[model samples]
Target: MTLLDGQVWTSDIYVDGWRPGRGEPWQVREPATGNIIGRVGTATTEDVAEAAAKAAKAQHAWQNTPYDERAAVLRRAGDLWNVHSGEVQEWLIREAGSIGPKAGLETHIAAQECFEAAALPSHPMGDVLPSTEPRWSMARRRPVGVVSVIAPFNFPLILSIRSVAPALALGNAVLLKPDPRTAVCGGVTLMRVFEEAGLPPGLLQMLPGGADIGQALVTTPEVRVVSFTGSTAAGQAVGELAGKHLKRAHLELGGNNALIVLPGADLERATSAGAFGSFMHQGQICMTTGRHLVHESMHDAYVEALASTASHLPVGDPHRGEVALGPIIDEKQVARIHRIVKSTVEAGARLAAGGTFEGPFYRPTVLAQMEPSMPAYTEEVFGPVAPVVPFSSHEEAIGLARRSEYGLSLGILGDVGTAMEIADSVPSGIVHINEQTVADEANVPFGGVGASGTGSRFGGPTANIEAFTETQWLTARPQIAPYPF
Candidate 1:
């Protein structure tokens, strides 16, 4: 494991393989301290084109590689990650602004994703079809050639690998563009892992850059699929570019997720769920519980209990083991969140607790009496702010929850039958009963609907096959048919 402390960490674009990058370097900083922790090379437009071309060239041989051999690379990468868990965790904390538990969770899920992706080869992809005539027909899953992965800063390692590992397992050459803020961990570290794991050189390319680089990858003719996880606006642009180019896109975008507490809900458990869901990683997660819709019967009590719970959570340096919530990604984000909170208060919402900040660390805040019109209630706060609203009935609660354009995840606390019924009718992709909405399991399909994302999922055992590979139908005739020509 390499120590990055007090050193200017740097990584070049991996074109076909690891090599020195030609473009300028961008300074990567620690969000909490505003210190330059590293410098990562940025890819020029030409660099993205070079990587895509190399990936396209590499895909043919990689796709033809045996399933066992491909799976071995993923397994080796997972093993290597486990060996250096400490460094990975530290890098996540410093580079991505993640707290201790969030950093640990990222590395753990990333390793598990690699292991689960190793099983993609063993899963069923081809099937025999019945035919009426004297002939045979079957369908086979084939690689989509070059895949372009665009990952965000939050949960960089896990989110990037959530798409990268599976695409590689299915025999597609990948071009990964990690967020500039987390380039060291998200790009360079993963490149090292794959290289040491005996993956074929040139099969995985890492190009670290901003929007221009991402645009180049999406528009490149050699690329067949694009897997992206980020803000909804960026996703919309990616989708448009992919659509214009006639390429397959797997997008996991923003979420203004809601958590509803019913009349009979257990107060203690619900408060715990609310606190965890709302303040984890300073509520940076897309699936963070943004809105709390409690039944009018329990609204006041729930808010008080949730505020008391939030007060006990420690907020400070992520490197410290005792800290619960870390800083926002930057001062800009902190200001944005505070502005929303202030405006909501002016518009009649009550700040029950925590509407202030100390540097990058915005205290965990609880807002009550939030109406549907307030920005904090309608939009994604994307910070440690949980806004609670009262609903008179179950139908009203459902209506309020479904009002958002973004439908990614939802949490409901109610009886099994009623909760399940509500879950079925919700417009989100992942729904939880008596639990928080955020999930990081390897065997569950994770994506969103509507403004949250495109209708593409890339996780779990079965879902990866759909996004990285395309199906081809094969027909064979044992005898010649009656010809019309």
Candidate 2:
């Protein structure tokens, strides 16, 4: 079925099938103009519980299905992503406030995620174990039955599908709860792809709602695992609730990542890398470079260069024009970003460039002479704001990078030897040498340390297997041995 049909309101939420949500219908608006682009149905907590139950029941047959069949479905889904790229990109641009390139990247990575997951079914499920007794022993990986994937608004398609694709490939049903703002690109689009690719009914359920639905998904007994990607505060709550309910929570949370520029680095190349890392996607990414630690010798030049680049980047409605950056997710997010920038300036940081905004279109901002204790330096400013701080020694840079509670991604621009040495001292889930902080691969283990996540990691074969399946020890004997009564 055609998913977007003239933008008329329809039942968008998927339970057993594409049906109307029991809750109110949400008007999907464009962040650039606040115009109603489309309407999608919203889910209630009761709907979440029912969807979870149905998903759990469907998972039994799915897990027992032939591996080839499962792999075929995943491969087809991957193909479908490319086939529907235009339609998907439209929704992403309108619904998620994504620039053209960012939207395209999401679609590309989504397809790659599916392709990677397609191979998961054929991978070795378990290992042979030695037994002391006279019996054959084995450790087998079994599906967790039902997985609940809670995705954030920023880069919704990639974040949601990375976990959803693998869980389904490994024989687990998934109940996806995307942020209400980007439900179309994040949830409805995915449901349409899997359905068209021959995914059976009840195998993947999309429930777009608010916190009530998310809480229900976590507490529901049918959901065996919770894969969450959002703020650290929200992740901590989900983790705590999942632990209380005896379910595994694979969290990919927030980050105040660092980009260190050493004295030996090429000033132009370093500034370019830092600008891309901080201002990409309006800096809504979890791995965006929040801190710029520059050597005192090159600090002034780096800040000047970065600010010049930021000032030239065009910010506007992506759908209307080809712009370097689009609007923030919503007015609230825009306000939050401005507050952080204003507070940082008040606290003594210098706003080198872009201290102002126009509606939701926050200008790409750069702050210089920043202290580690300032809000802009410490908090995860999920906006196009780069706070540049100077450090005299490599030791000081490493110490500043390690100061944040988050350990998601780190970037170092310098000689190979010096960058690698500094990388060794810093703790981060991802480290980029002479590259930007924001990066991802479909096959790489993606997650973070400390408050960034639970460190369960997502992506790659080993991590996917561990995240979606439970290990069971099995033993067999030629004959049943009787125990003494």
Candidate 3:
């Protein structure tokens, strides 16, 4: 059957198989043209309970299945991703408002995530431990029955599958809840991929809904873990609720990342990196460069060059034309971005580039002479807005970077020795020398700290093992020793 079979995308949710959701139907729209692409089902709290129950029941057998069998399923899923890359990229462009390159990147990464997870099943799952008593002792890892993945609209495919694939590969069932706006690409697409790959029924459920559905997933007793990727405020709530329920929560939250341009850096190359980091996917990425810190001696030239680069980049309907950027996810996001720009501009920051928008297409913007207190400087503007600040010394740059509550990603463009030294002082989870903030690899551990996330990094063998499994200590003896009275 084709990837976009009638039952998959048309259905509201996936429980035992594709089915209608109990809640009202949701109309999925293209942000650029404001056109309804399709109407799909929305899940309710009742649906979440039912899906969680099914997942819990399925986990026992899935875990007991041979390790090679589990690994084979993930391998097939990865191959399917590659086989249908074109169709998935189309969905990403139309549903997620991704430009051509961004859409291609998402499809590529989705496949890689599956491929990486395929190796997880065969990895060593435990270690031998020395015991005081004359007994064989070991510590082993086991799946956390059911995982609830709440994925955001931005980079939905990558974020959702990064957790979903690994959890399934490690022998756990998954309940995926994608943001309603981009549910088709994020939720339904995944359901189809694994289904075609021959995943067992009731092992994976896709429930597309809003906050209420998310809450239900967190509180469901069958769900032992919640993998959340979204705003910091929402992540905080998820983390808190999961804690109250005594569940493990893997949160990859928001970031107000910084890109520092030190002395002796190439102006052209620095501006190019800055523009890409701030405007890629309209800067909706969690690791987007929100702040640009340049040495005072080169601040003015850097600002001019960066604004020139931003102004030249194209922004329009990705499906209609070749463009560097696409529309904001919705009008609400557009309004939020404009408000940040207006407030920051009024607070003495100069609008160096674009500060206007039409429809959902906000121009790539650059704000100069920014301070710590400005909204654009402090808030995580999930839009294509870049704020530039100047620092006189490396100490001042480090201080400015550390001023925020976020410690997600940091980028430094300068001498290797100086950049490495500066990186050592920053408390971010990921740091890049002579590179932009937006970077990811399937085999690398990806996450953030402080307000950005819970520090339970995702991806890589070690982090995924820790994120999806629980530790159990076991000991055995030929005979039981008598207890001393």
Clash totals, every prediction: 1, 0, 1
Cα lDDT tens digits, model 2, 270-292, are 99899999999999999999999
TM-score of candidate 1 on Cα atoms, chains taken together? 0.96
On residues 211-310, what C-alpha lDDT tens digit does candidate 3 reach at each position?
9999999999899999999999999999999999999899999999999999999999999999999999999999999999999989999999988888
CA lDDT of 376 in candidate 2? 96
* CA lDDT scores, all candidates in order: 0.87, 0.92, 0.93
Across 325-444, the per-residue lDDT of candidate 1 in tens digits comes to: 988998888999999999999999998989989999999999998898899988888999999999998789889999899999999987878788778777988888999877768768
Candidate 3 Cα deviation (angstroms), residue 73 = 0.6
Arrange candidates, best TM-score first: 3, 2, 1
lDDT of 1 at 161: 88
Say which prediction, candidate 1 or candidate 3, comes out ahead on TM-score: 3
RMSD to true structure for each model, in Å: 1.9, 1.2, 0.9
| Model 1 backbone overlap count | 1
